[model samples]
Target: MLKTILHYINVNRWRLIKISKNNFLIYCSVFVGLMGGLAAVALKYLVHFMEDLSRNIGAHVPFHFMYIFLPALGILLTILYQHLVNRDQIQKGIGTIIFNIKRNKANMKFNNVYSHLITSSLTVGFGGSSGLEAPIVSTGAAIGSVTGRFFKLTTHQKSLLIAAGASAGIAAVFNSPIAGVLFSLEILLGEISIPTFIPLLIASATGVVVAKILYSRQLFHLATEGWHLQALPFYLLLGLLSGWTAIYISNVAHKLEKGIFKKQNRYVRAVLGGLILGVIILIFPPLLGEGYHYLQEVLNGNINVLQEESLFSTWLQHPLIMAGFIAALVFMKVIAAGITLGSGGNGGTFAPTMFTGAFLGLFVAYAVNLTGWVHLNTSNFIAVGMAGALSGVLHAPLTAIFLIAEITGGYILFIPLMIVSAISYIIARLSNSHNMYWHDLIHEKNVRPDKDYEMLTAIEIRKVVNRKYTAVKRNRPIKELYKLMAETSTNIFAVLDDEKHLQGVVLLDELRKRIVDGTLSATATIEDLMIEPPAVIEYNQSAEDVMDLFDTLDVWQLPVVYHGRFVGFVSKSNMLTEYRKVLIGQHHQPDPFGH
Candidate 1:
């Protein structure tokens, strides 16, 4: 009984709790949302905590010395975080999430998640060129999932809580509750179902409120106090280009991350990452740190934007040089993103994405102004283009649209924001990029997308698992059951009627339970204790590739069927070993992965 109780608790924890179909879950969602908001607030504070320490230290260091110290700090801190704090922090941040869903039975390791959060915060705080929002989103969702586990949640309940957590995180960071909710649905949860949508909304609202209460200031700084809207069509062109730029960034981030991950030793990989950061910082100090200062300069338009403006710092502006530098910096940021992930220097992809988009916008504005549109407002074009590209990359157009309006405080960049965001999403999709974070991470695991990612924009269990199946007679005793399971040593086994068709599943845990309980005598049949019609994976399917199903199906293993017969089974352990084998390469050869 003690064992049974313990197993029940383990199985049920970190799940969504269902009080009822309607009333109870909704209440739980409210609680989850509030906590999510708090988590976001905490994440922001944590990031600043690191930044404050860096600022104190950096104040003493010479300006040029920052080029050396910044990257060195990135190196030391990264090694410490990976080797000492979270060994499992590897697989990249987004990849870690996806990998856990695939191989770890959808069981998220809370220790590892928060470890990444703090470490990532430190990376950016200490002048690492990365983003704050990505880590926060990942950590917030992880915290929500971990907290939900404590409540004995159901799978649906857990997903709801997780979505709420993500929404809160985004809302808190951007101070845009609507965008937070949209980010949760579009990026993390990948759906806007009633079950997920309502809870996420509450969470985002709570998060935004908390951020507002704490900061009482705007999140993004957009300068458009006295801009003319007569050149709206020109702004549309800017948006179109910016959107295309977002797609380009996404592709670059993915490809580079994959290439960098191939490095054999973690230390060597990290050292290389440090070296790259060093080079970029040396060339352009504005490109150093988390890039907030660089963004501020762009917003303030204090420095020359055209690469050749006035003095180096405050002199006249140089348009040609400014354009070249912006373009170069755009490429540099993508490489930085890849390096951050490769070195395990914990940070989000969103912050870098936003910074790159802003630069891209500025580039377009500069070129347009060069065309003799001097009467047009360069700052206004910059604001709209930035917002639109941000929206497009994030796949949250509505949120992106409204967010700019709010961040700019009643100033309207809506028309240009829509144009850029929509087109950017299209271009990114056209280039076959997934969420940069998720895609880069997935690619790290070397899992080829069987279908175009667009086909998987959202996945259904039916697509991943098949109902049709073949099985053995359940009337057979344990001796026969062992034989069948031996042939297919997966977590789940099919128990059929005399007709050799589906009846129930002999899950490994259930099988172990029966053995320990001694409930079934040697003569007893499989029917005495089997789950009927276990979730099945159809052959030739896209692997739906989500962590949610592991809990919802309540099995660590699943059988795969193609036309009418059982082809194979996929288990959590099986997939993990597969990844492990790939990582091991030519050195080790586990039977499952031995070439």
Candidate 2:
């Protein structure tokens, strides 16, 4: 059985770890890379197979009526799968992978390997306007997480393997190994070093090799010879537009994700999303699914005939009309992609972003050509637009440049890619502080990538809490409270109930004022002088959040609560000291303990 094999591997991996940790990680990275590549292959093939199956089914139906229900069916099936199989509810996506990396120490569930593969494939292949890249990335991260667990890897080692698997998945999908490495570093790992780089590079290259062996077709091509110095200004302008477009798409996608999909009934939302998507695709077939075929048509100057076979062919003949239509499609694509995800469908914005950028470029080229002011190479613009838009959306200019150049075989456009990607990245950075995918992580989940801060986030409030503080009974006189504060060498005193439950705090400052006024009385109880604490820290809350509470409340300390009982108080000084220790430890600085 598989359990026997895992047990054998687990026992031997400890022996290997004794030999060398680095060697064990390097060896494990190879297996993670292979698994990532294989997962990518499997997902891509499944998507294609489902696409073909849908096409065959649509052939027999009148007016392709099956298209309306296909996405709904796919989403419902995914929901059904969640109810039946994923009852424990392991979230499936790149976001969950990144979340686990930062919060869970890269501990991922084994089921993620197949969960996203099945759901995302059904979502995209059955007419959902989304990408498969995220699902594959999720699957790959799961593979690495489980593999690391199998070897009992350290937290940092597990994180590196997760990054390696993600890189391998991207490399396999796009056949761009260098971009894959950059993607992991910029978006996932957030740091670069030789130890991380070598493993990621090996995994990425291995992934591309696997892809080449299995599926040798390139994704896109561009005749970059047409890129001239005369087009420099236009490319710059395109970069600005691409960056703004990315910001718009990101904001709209996130807003829709949080707003319209407000945890409503899945069936109702799915129906609404499907109806709107069906209507849009029926009117503009180029906006359907990934729209890669239509992008090729636009690049070839076949926009007028690209979707002429659709039901809305009456307005498709005129070049000006088609240009305006394509421009509108660029914005609508963002909305549809948002809806596809918001309506319980599973997919990513990667392919749809490229689709939007390419058409937006074509539209700009057409509009300028019609003015008879400047002649522009539409194909070159399309390529640059893809890079710029990707940079803007991802806030990762290097990954954008290399991903486009490698996928399109456009080495000649490298300078232009750099130019456009940089411009777009700057504009996007100004417009939005974080990448589209990172909003939930940074804001809601507090999973930032900074190592020192992450270390602080990893520390719990209980670790730094001052549990030796004196607790006075609520009915204790103010004079006795003064004695307790003086004897305890603490400025703060807690008033506790009979059951040791927290009631309030009695500050020495307040007692000093009462004593100085000569108004203190023997009958005045501690509760009379006690004031409710401004902030409370939970036992399991992160030190980072505890620091935020301190900063927000402008207090030196906050009461730590477990249930309703008073555990202790965590002071700002202790939190800061621990934070300094974590920072120093992260940099391998010499400590007093010689650790």
Provide the lowest-lDDT 10-residue window in model 2. Answer: 586-595
lDDT per residue, candidate 2, 511-582, as tens digits? 889888978776898888889999877888877778788888899977888988899989999998888776
User: What lDDT, from 0 to 1, does candidate 1 have?
Assistant: 0.62
Report lDDT per candidate. Answer: 0.62, 0.80
lDDT tens readout by residue for model 1, 41-65 = 6666777787777767767887566
TM-score of 1: 0.69
User: What TM-scores do the predictions have?
Assistant: 0.69, 0.84
> Ten-residue segment with the worst summed lDDT in candidate 1?
586-595
